[model samples]
Target chain A: MLAVLVGSGAMAQEIPAEPAIETAPEPEPIPEPPPVLHPPRNIVAQDVPHDNGGVLNIQWEPPIEGVPVRYVLEMAGEDGFFQEVTRTALTQYTVMQLENFVPYRFRVAAVYEKGQSMSPETEPVMARDHWLKLGEMPVLIAIFVFGSLLLFFIQAARRGVELFVRRISGLTAVEDAIGRATEMGKPVLYVPGTSTIEDVATLASLNILGEVARRTVHYDVKIICPNKDPIVYTIAREIVKETYASEGRPDAFDPDSVFFMVPDQFAFAAGVDGIMVREQPATIFLMGMFWAESLIMAETGASTGAIQIAGTDSVAQLPFFITACDYTLIGEELYAASAYLGREPMLLGTLKAQDYGKLVFLIIMVVFTLISVFSGYDAASLVRVR
Target chain B: MKRRFPMTIMFLFAIWGGISVFVGKTKVHDFDNLLRNKLLLIVGAFAIILGLGSLIFHHTQKIKRKARFWQYSYVTLIALAVTTFIGLGGGVRGERSLPTIFGGTVIGAHDGLVYVFTSQAEKNLFMDEPSRYADPTKAVLELPREFETDFNRFEASQLREEIHLKHTALQLKGQPIPPMISPVSNQQVAYKKEFKISLQQLYEGILVPCGSTMFAMLAFYMCSAAYRAFRMRNLHAGVLLVAAFIVMLGQIPLATAFIPGLHELRQWILDVPNLASKRGIMIGVGLGASATSFKIILGIERAWLGGGE
Candidate 1:
């Protein structure tokens, strides 16, 4: 019997066994439950108003049940693929610098601890430019009033109406200074400030330079003007040349008189100081905007014992000018210098308009103070720009 | 015509500038940006070229005429040339060398011994017992006969320090080896780009210090000016002197401590009276600037255009 069992085992080993038969084709495996997800709702995208365009205000509501860890905002592409814009904890976001005229769709997803679910996509919204900015109405009205006053005064001057302008001592001294330079046989040094042409102070200084150049020509006195900006140098050179030509002494205008020294502030100051020490000009005119170098240049001019006249709209530099200069045109006086020097009626009219604007400002200040005291209203806020 | 053309352009641009300030429209901003960024940038570039030409012409004329301080022009021109050459040729960051050779790494340990997988060429030499390579710069196989027997952590560290010292000496000479695998530590040893001097260093070391010195000179100038300005020649001078004294005294801790409520008093002066005067000046300046801008825009102020009516 053992030999027979061995023979059967040998036979089983020799032959390939058939496939085993199953009892109930194996019990089917249990399926996992679908994950519970909470998504944000009521996603909205609106065009931001009073903008240059390309801005949208996106807002969303949180999920109904549980609070989300955060929100994921997405913008849809042309292929309907959602690209993540930002992940934020807040419900609202401002998307800026989008294509102005292009329509955009947005979706928000509530990111929970377990999983995230997306909200219904918002309707297509397009950013558009508004005709006028409503927030700037106060500024617009103020500009209009000031402009009207200016026009009115200009017309009045054109009609030969007399205008009174206070004498600026600095401007009155300009001719005398040039005459002194002529007497001393020394050049008159003029610094037209260390600023670009874009600066209004530089423009004012240029206007004043024109008048100064004309006076220099009349006196036959040499003038030396140093500039820090290349554009200002060009303009100043032209003004000097043209002033000499108009005075019928074009040959007297030396092209090298008005020159660009340097662009760097302290470097220009050092150069100007060197020029002052070496040349020893009889009179120095410091005009336009100055910074820390104001004291440097002014002190150097003082050391040379020159009669220095300074004019600037820079409030900080005013003290330095007053300290080191014999005559100073403070604040608005610098702007009125051209009119004062030339005695032009139209220019004087503009000066009158500026004075009127100041009067209006004074009245507004008084009214605002009264309203604040009596009615507890923030009158300042009414004119406050956003 | 030359004057009229520029005046007309200026007038149109000035009006546009005013509108651009108040308008939030895209078209207005685009045009404004175009003028400010693109157009102005182009004009500025041309202006710089003209400025350089002017500088050259001025200096050359001064040198030819042997004007006062003509020798200084040579210094300026030479400095400009040298700076330009250094910036363009040597590069701003300065020169650098190739990386150093990689030494071996400690692979594993045998019975009372640590084995290192050395270089490929060295290993090949051991396997085949070939002749030395022709290149001397390549790392040499220096496996001593007594290496296995006399090897210790101390000798390995000493060797590493010796190599590091050599590299440091090279670095001080501005010839730094970039990076290499350290033999003893079995890690990378990196050396930063070391040079004698860089453009940025030159700017910081020379230019910045010069600027600071000039700025520092202002304090002395201010003191001198203050002495002259604060003299009691008149009522205005006395008022200025008193105000300056109070402000200066208020700034010092010892003075503030001695005088009670000195800080508050100073604050009141600054916040109320000083601020009121400053604001008044600012308002006047603003109105004047607006009026000037209006005159320029309306072509009423044409003196800026070369003494025109």
Candidate 2:
């Protein structure tokens, strides 16, 4: 048989018997499945505060021992079908951009290479819309206190209680400046700052501008208000027109005097500078929120030998104005100018209220400093506004 | 009616604005935004019209009376007209919708130059495939990196998504890369093409430089003003001069090295006196401004009503 097999193999190479394939050794015992993943504990889902809803803050405590697990956050809406929202190795997540008033149930699953272990589903947390934010408590308190004081003083003033506001030299010089303009037969350049009406400083300046306009109406000094904001230009035209009309010199109110120059800050400055160099108004009121242009305008007016009165709540620009302008209203003086100059009882009342508030604040500040210094009580920390 | 109507509206809106601050958990979810935003848009439209009217009237009067530097008004008016017309004619982005109904699904242009919108190749539409790399704020598009972008997450998410439809798979034999959305769908689609002029290009190229140039004139004005301001004549001026000089010197490391404790002095001035004064002013301004708001609301301040008209 061996000879036949050898002869067959020799005759045809394909005649060789197929070698018996060795039976595969029994596969090694299948490795024990990885230990069951430990689910996270203390899963809490809460609505985010001070938001317009649609946000949930989910937090969990990770199990100490896990099979190299990653946490998978799953959410189910009204559809009740849990969908994997995200995966993370974090203990907390702020889910954002959800629909308001939607009930969302969240579950966290510890997912390992072998299997997953899920925590019990959290109670459906409905995101409720909240209006007031707790962060603004200090602002609210300050406003309430300040507003009540103002109203109280105004009421007192209305009932013939005389309120005294300190004299501001800048405002007292208004008459002199306008008088000088009337004597020089030159225009009175009243700039209501480069800012719009949204700025309180601009509003304060506008109030002062109205008074200055009224004062100049009988004096016959042409008042030119170069406006940088169109709305302000329109409003200024009205104020000047009304002031002239009320003073029985309606024809003197030239609409073009309150024209708007370019809105660009520097361009407006340049335009006003050109006007200053050309017309050389005897008096200039550079008031309101001015930036770099404050110096340029004031210096140009000063170079023209005009009596320049600059005022602004912007402390950065105050130094420049004080250096260039003949009279500068620093900080609170700018706000106090309307009452000081116009002598309106309503405004004077507000000013007095502000002074009282300041006095109270100053006393508290000194007391707090003393406490913080000597007693180490940190009273400053308690009343810190922002 | 003119005064009362506005005052009523202002009072109501002011009250609304003030009260809206602390009502987040109420049933009025987004009521503040909806009402305020809508009203603002309407008023803004009217304000634009009024602004245009005032601008035209002012310029026309200037030209009629031949006011000083009246010739420059013509430049402004003409520029305004040209830019407004250009913006209107070409649209802000030069995007114009022309509807064309073509039968069949995604019949691309010759050489597969355009992609029909039948296959959701539109901007802002969700993609079937996920992105390669994801950031909270980065746009998902694989656009050319040369384009400048904003750091706004919402805007980035609203951009066109990258679709990797190979030209070979689409049987595009030979084509340039001007990916376009065709007008096969009912909704409007943008068909982009290379080398097209746009109004945005004009705005970015011309108007931006003009504005920048106008702003650039401030440096010269500042230098001139500073020269006039820094001169010493009085004690106050001397104090200011010394303070400014010290502050300026303290900023320079070489000067600080020579004058030991100069930087510390400057820091003390800035931290103690300067900050104290600033805080005092800020508190005053805050109270004053809030009082003004209350005054306006209560109708005690009528200066905005035109000299007590």
Judging by TM-score against the true structure, name the best candidate.
1
Q: Model 2 - which docking category? A: acceptable
RMSD (CA, Å), candidate 1 to true, equals 14.6
User: For candidate 1, lDDT tens digit of each residue in A24-110?
Assistant: 777688898866787888888999888677889998888888888999999974567789999999999999888888888999999
DockQ scores of all models, one per candidate: 0.41, 0.28
lDDT of 2 by residue, A5-39 (tens): 99888897656688999998998999987686788
Q: What CAPRI class is candidate 1?
A: acceptable
Best by lDDT: 1
Best by DockQ: 1
Taken over the whole model, the C-alpha lDDT of each candidate is 0.79, 0.73
**Worst-scoring 10-residue span by lDDT in model 2 chain A:** A377-386
* Residue B178 of model 1, lDDT score: 38
How many Å off is the CA of B71 in candidate 1?
Answer: 2.5
